[model samples]
Target chain A: MSISLPKAFNEFDEARQKGFIDVKELKEKGKNIVGTYCVFTPWEIILAADAIPISLCAMSDEPIPEAEKHLPRNLCPLIKSSYGFAITDTCPYFYFSDLIVGETTCDGKKKMYEYMNDIKPVHVMQLPQTTIGDDSYNLWRNEMVVLKERIEKEFNVEITDENLKQAIKARNEERRMLKKFYELGTLCPPPITGLEILKVLYGATFKTDKNEQNQTIDNMIKSVMEEYNNGVRKVSEDAPRILITGCPTGGATEKVIQIIEENGGAVVCFENCTGVKGNDTLVNEDIDPIDALTDKYLNVACSCISPNDNRIELLDRLVDEYKVDGVVDIVLQACHTYNVETYRIKKFLNENKNIPYMSIETDYSKSDIGQLQTRISAFIEML
Target chain B: MSISLPKAFNEFDEARQKGFIDVKELKEKGKNIVGTYCVFTPWEIILAADAIPISLCAMSDEPIPEAEKHLPRNLCPLIKSSYGFAITDTCPYFYFSDLIVGETTCDGKKKMYEYMNDIKPVHVMQLPQTTIGDDSYNLWRNEMVVLKERIEKEFNVEITDENLKQAIKARNEERRMLKKFYELGTLCPPPITGLEILKVLYGATFKTDKNEQNQTIDNMIKSVMEEYNNGVRKVSEDAPRILITGCPTGGATEKVIQIIEENGGAVVCFENCTGVKGNDTLVNEDIDPIDALTDKYLNVACSCISPNDNRIELLDRLVDEYKVDGVVDIVLQACHTYNVETYRIKKFLNENKNIPYMSIETDYSKSDIGQLQTRISAFIEML
Candidate 1:
């Protein structure tokens, strides 16, 4: 489902740019394949299991008439869309479907694991819905090891420690490169727009070759920074300082940034699960690489899955570091993690710091543009 | 604690209004009330049997250091204020040495009940959080009856079936008056400002006497309807229609309405657990009155307890009746219920209807108004 739909929705620009490994061709490449679902963690290692490809379900337009037929309409849309895609054989390669991973951020997603397990082979992991401490991260690290083991056994493959270390190295290298891309944002003119950074980040995830992803990011970052250094697109210093964090705002990202800038605010800093949560941190290699990788992943764990994920702290830090006047927690429809975090962020800001924090959760659609503008205008005027 | 706290913080609106029920004068009043606790159901019959005053723990500005110590820093301020009033003994009427009552809602509130029961004598009733079907309604109805019997036995008072019916009538009448107030919103000019309605509705919950509440509401509703009929606040016809729902948006309600109007959108309808979830459908007198009342309460059950209690049909009905082009599901801080419901509402709107719905969660303060306004404006534009 992940393979075909990313193509159908044109979700992966990097993958297409790099070159294609068609599902049929990829299938011809190996057997005893294994599959798993993922959101935050890298798919590179899962593929390196020398098993089948592990796909990240980034949401695509596909029908799930069968899953939707039995499930209540109120269930999360991603689950519905995945089930819809699965049943239709959109990704016919998913037939083996060794395992499915799920998290518990909101009730709907919590139920998604339980609901899907009834229909097919499944593996469920309870992700932390709140950012607490190091507890959730450590727990998830242990669970990931177990999940990896289960995948190895299912595929009848030997997942050697050395191979696992290599996978960790590859993922860390990707993170470093992505961080370099984001660092360009610090430039006076921000050589790269937020969208440019987002595109390269998302592109890296779908592309299998780690070295190619690093090169693309390094090149883009260099090019953009050079342009900004040469006095290209200039960013005003007196613009309204804004902090952007939480889940995907979809296409609304540009609209949000535009609205903020128009209303005397500039999105100077952002902490989106997609944009920065997994970008800045690197896996430690000195210790047991597995535990080191786990520790690193835990330290920089993104997604709504981590219980210890304190979005308020992220916003607070951004506000302090960037001199942000306001913080906006933009959430996607059917994303439970951010919805739950929205309240905590608002409370912490209102009670402790008196910082203005606003939450906006929506489905990515072009129609909501005007409503979004008025709200932004009013919020800015009040500020 | 309730009595002592009100005295401490010195907010006497409750004490003065409950009619001179002073802690110092308790001995003179000749009531052997050792302690007091607030209740929703007829648990009072049980407290009375046990020779205790189940004081409806009305909102009080009392200081409760103990409660503040136990609760999370991010819990609802309103709830914290209530607890504060309890411990300070300024509202020293509550027989804290005897009992208290609590219902399940958000994780914070749920944990609050767990803490209260362990630290103090507490009577807990699992309140229905959602009203979806007749079976669930009947289940709550049965629970209410069992509760009444238990109360009678505990208090050692012969609460005859007749007394139970009267209590039921009192609550039903309270609801009916509240419904009448809500109906006034249907008028062309909406008899009163949205803020006025919210103030009155939340204010009335602390009042135990049915007659006084009904009288106040009846007058307010009448005046509002009269003003609407007299064409007091009608607006232009091109305004975009909006249906606002979910948990309370607090002060954001007015800002939302103002932004919508300014952006050529009209907030024609609103349905919130705090505002309308308690304004249940009319009771059927022909049926067992107590049973009927229970069902009614469960029918409009607030989505503050669990996501399992969602009424998508009710939401659909609102969209149809109100001619809504968009929806905004506001999730208040520490409110897990509305946060969960926000996801469901978003998914439902996306797949089933064309209406654009945006979810916003708040901590009930003055910040984030700009972000909310932006989201609202974009939503209206889409519509």
Candidate 2:
């Protein structure tokens, strides 16, 4: 599945290098930027407070050596890389962030945030371990207020109801556009390669201009659909459709997807933080904005939530929707929540979804490319 | 540091094998038994429901191969062993349990409980990542009610206030007694070996009779103190006084203690779950039983908390109180919280306490004994 992507996809790809210049200019223009790490972050409040939110570059292996100086070598690469970037001033977005928002997503990331605080001002939201009971609801909802107030106090901006409503509308529209774009996998033969699809999705994080980012995604979807409708199939119908889940995957860990696709599998959908987990659910425009934000953000189904039945539920729907033939979980090394939850996920996919399931656990290091290739190639052969 | 103990310490040693028979007999006699894995479990509720509680035997490597069939290889060995025991019926204590109660204290254990629930009815209480907010208090307090209700319904019994008060009194006495026993480590040129102290502390979990457990602790404390007061110096006064912290260390992981003690170090305190983390705080008898239980259990400084200041505070106090010269943290392999936290713990002790802090990450495998001896021997020499 390889072809030159149209101008729209190229724009999305270049957004990363371009975002640095954009963010620098925005900073010079006195714009407020808040760096984030998880999908659970309520971006609506930051938008309402007139602040730009950046997903701190955490998926790469580049700064991991620096992070291992302060963090343990056995920790998740995402946390270490992110912290490394912060401490080393290696991530331009981090340098540009006026404030950083972190959620209690996992033990590794949460504790790393404590260390990150010395480098930058970090406001952490206490997330509930489960989405059941009144305590879970009130705790999360109150946390929205906490973040909102913190943003208000920090930026000297008032988040009025009108501002919130507009933020909600704009963000919801972007989510809907992204959701429709990713749903291109539902085609019997995907129009674009999985690698291209990932490039667009992963690059969306760096685009500071939300309006341009959404337009690029909308254009990419139309372009891909146009090619597919014209009888152009980049992915073969015989190729096994692979649904990737578990931890966030991009830079170093993307080797798993490359191996899967290279060995006769097309990664049709991603159920982890980088894919539908971030953009699948939309906030209700009718309810109070905070309540809407709380429900939507809490529903993202990170494995940190105990009895995270939502993840199982999402995976089930994803397999059916994408006509997935096999599931490949992209697990980051030392990610306890996802690593442990892999058992339940495997059992569920095996018994209920009737799909062959497999998981690959690797860190940010590229040392295991050969091993991942061997295992993933065999897995794809079986599929 | 080896001496034939009086009948009291001997009774504690026999309790493990003896407990299997006693637990079986109690099961035959139709006594309800509830199994727990952490100190955060509010035992008073189960006691009020007239059920015996046991720490489901988890600190071993024996059953881990069976667990690895379902769980990932790179998980905390404690979770793997516990899950293995439940699935294989290898642990007699697990076999006798009418119910199992697990708290979401850590990701590995919490997710493993979901699978264990399939083997036996398991109740999971959601634990907060922080103890700062009303949500932390209210959520934990409400969970106490939920657990109380679950116990009442499961056993067809009422948990009356009077029942709670009596349970609290009995449990508090046992806690105080155990606290007094472990505090003997504070005595310069300590009377008992660290392994001997661990034996009694770990063995106490198997004793189904709360009264007998408390009395054994009382008697053992009296015996050790009497010998120490009489100028019986088993431990060298010149040895480096060390404090043990981090994950539970008893079975395979206790090799850290052996290597340290074998090399000229006297472990003066254990700040981990198997030691002070279990018995340091007493439930407030004057407050509402649920609130008291919540406050006391929440105060136990597990590394699961976001800002685990309590652990640092406890470690700081323990170093001073134990008159400690060095700190050794026993980290279990893939135990993300403690492993990542080693950085903060090491930084704090160096900056504030002026002590050398080192952490050893091990599993239940004896393969690491040689490595541990080499590393721990060097650490002791540094002290």
**Model 2 alpha-carbon drift over 4 Å, by segment:** A1-4, B1-7
Residue-level lDDT of model 2, residues B279-320, one tens digit each, is: 888888998888788888877798888788899889889999
Once fitted onto the true fold, the runs of candidate 1 whose alpha carbons sit more than 4 angstroms away are A1-24, A31-48, A51-55, A59-84, A87-98, A118-120, A128-141, A234-241, A251-268, A297-309, A320-325, A334-337, A347-356, A380-383, B1-383
Best-performing candidate as measured by lDDT = 2
Prediction 2 TM-score vs. true = 0.96
Index of the highest-DockQ prediction: 2
Task: Compute the lDDT for candidate 1.
Answer: 0.54
Q: B1-383, model 1: which lDDT tens digit per residue? A: 01232131122224234433443354354443433232234432433343333343333323424455645444444455456555454454453234554543333443344334544555554444334334345445655665655555554457665664655555567778777776555544444444445555544543434586677566655555565555766554455666778654333245665666677676666676445554545555566656665755555545542334335777777777666678877655544445545556677887887778887665434477788778778878887
Determine which window of 10 residues in candidate 1 chain A has minimal summed lDDT.
A1-10
Q: TM-score of A-chain in each prediction?
A: 0.78, 0.97
* Cα error of candidate 1 at position A33, Å: 7.4
